[model samples]
Target: MHLDVIIGVSKNNKSGACDVNDIEKLGSDPKVVELFKLKKDEVIFDDDSDIFITSGSTGKPKYAVHTHFSVINGVKGMFYYLEGMPNKENRRIILGLNTAHISGEGSGVLSPLVASMTSVFAPPVYNIKQIVQTIQNERCTDVLFLITYLYDMLNFKDIGEYDVTSLDICLTGGSNIPPKLAKDFEEKFACKILIAYASTEMMVPSISSPWDPLEARCSGVRILPNAEIQLVDDDGKCVPLGSNGEIWCRCCSNFQRYMGNDEQTKAAKSPHGWFKTGDLGVFNAAGVLSIVGRKKDMIDRGGIKIFPADIENVLSQHPSIEQVQVIGVPDERLSEEICICLRTKKNAIIEKDQIVSHLTGKVRLEESVPGYVLIFDSFPKSITGKIDRMSLTKQAIDRIQSKVQ
Candidate 1:
């Protein structure tokens, strides 16, 4: 079960000198020799097996084990939702994601191989200029960009200089995208933007289709075939439609288990094979699933449940705000209070009152408005590049404590 044989070792081999035959001899390669020396045991795997390392954004990263069967099933699901069969005429793709994670490994590497498509690996640094150059040069028909990367690309000063007319579809996920950003990207690029919802445990359960209506395309993803989704409340009871709940998913592409972490795996999976995604989401009347936020990220301010995404979405529209993260901080009176950390546009000046006014006009609930606001040069991110809410919350607490002293 040499998993490398499926996706090929060429990309994984840091040194271009290695071939399939030389995979076992990767230790001898000068480029990876030091890496092998430090983590030799972790690198070795049984033949014909695939190992996926979790991003560890929530806690310590875990090794997820996958077999050839699981990989095939996952790839099959990818093509199932695709408009048509992949062919030489329409198979060229640009992959901008890091191949270390499932999103990149599965969609960027394995899917192309299984579907016999040409996948152009985007530059490692994610330079917007270089990425646009590759897309224009290769005339890629399909491409996948992380939501954050796409945000930066949309804001790139020289974006209009590139000839991206060849792109047919652009896919993004891993976080909630502001509606304004999504709409702007579609209008600016003249290509269909497919917002996907997937996890490492469940390869890819849903992706909005190019043919979907603008509202559906902007609001939520359409659940893919052979995938089942159910929203459950605190007691594990399925929630009513259009109500927020923990997203539980069952699909053919589900991962086998967390390598050597039985307790965590058991806690995440149910007896019926449903994997609790730990994400709060709601299914609209149209059956489109909209991710609200992480259950752990929900702010309980005096028994009122506030989703950071709701605040982040509204604040993201502020012309001066480049990136914003809403978090909950401890308050003796209210148990928790909404705190917003903002990254402003260069040379942009924003006042706390301005943010309050913006939220007051946009957010329907008064409790949802941030009570505390802190400005930062930039938000701290985890290894996967997602906002580190935990770190931001700690920073907010420290700032509040310092003022009291």
Candidate 2:
């Protein structure tokens, strides 16, 4: 694929630029020439243009095709969002994500390029210290980070020493964003966190506006322009407004198809073009969309459905807990049991009973209380920097089995 060649070219060229001489030195390839020509001629790519490979966080990797119509319109949506922020002309952003994924490609690379803004790249391996230093050094105006990054920054005690006053607006998503975390980060860093709802297939469907109330920051996001969203039940029927259902989105920027995966594409997309996001969401009366959890990640214990985000949200409020990942493990009587893998804050001691006590009244249901609380120094992460729940589930199971043995 052309993107494959571009990935290789990006790696060899640390400067994030390439010329005819550089291409010649790397050995002339027709695909490389085609890529440069596409850039030079400024021609729009057709709908069949295979652009990016999904991070495979959900399952197997799939290639996504993006027409220039989608990209330009998607960037236009970003410009609309930026209209709410201050300093329209001089915007500097910190990029600390893997560019391979759509989040990184869109927010870190494409958004900056299209806006003609300065982007300060963080280290390949995310380091809160380095990120803070870069922001202080560069006087960065904006930063978009994953939820985990927020937790890390909050845990970093020395952040008070940094002068990040230049930060006007920041953003985070990729999973259920804990409201407590968002509030705490803003209190400490003095920057508002706008939650966004997006996917690799759907370029950016929604984002919380800059003027949203502080309490509403991580609660939900307002749908962006040129996007239509419908919440549907398992039966594929649309749910009532303000009810929870899978998020189906239709936008000009939505991917045309999953390259070479017609079966998957058909499964995700409707005949009319709405893509099932596999994420559960509810709409508030004001039309803000709140993502509750992943539909597939629901834990079925004795036929009682448990959404991990519900439990994780309560757990994250604990002063000692820095990060938490909830998963379901096989159980003889329960069918599947809730297991919470947690990374504690520095020098914080937590016991299983303490955690159980903490969740007893906080969780939506009694069964939502975790059957297993495994404390870890760190949770395994996917390439896109989100929690690697697949690997984490295996690790949790193995640890449980070893104890039984």
Computed on alpha carbons, the lDDT of every model, listed in order, comes to 0.80, 0.82
lDDT of 2 at 64: 86
Model 2: residues with Cα > 4 Å off, grouped in runs: 1-45, 48-50, 157-161
TM-score of 1: 0.86
TM-scores for all candidates: the values are 0.86, 0.89
Question: lDDT value for candidate 1?
Answer: 0.80
* Candidate 1 lDDT score at position 393: 81
Worst ten in a row by lDDT for model 2 = 1-10
Q: In order, how many clashes per candidate?
A: 3, 0
> How much is 64 displaced in model 2, in angstroms?
1.6
**What's the residue-level lDDT of 128 in candidate 1?**
79
Instruction: Report the C-alpha lDDT of model 2 over 188-207, residue by residue, as the tens digit.
Output: 77888888888889888788
lDDT of each residue in 1-405, candidate 1, tens digit only: 224333244455554344666566775788798776677666433323667877666777778777666667777777665526445446678988888888888887877776667789888765778988999999987888877777777788987888889887788888888877777778888877888888877888888877776567867888878689999999899998878999999987787888778999999999999999999999988898989989988889988888888888888889998888888898898898988888898899999888888888578575445778889976766676666677778888899889889
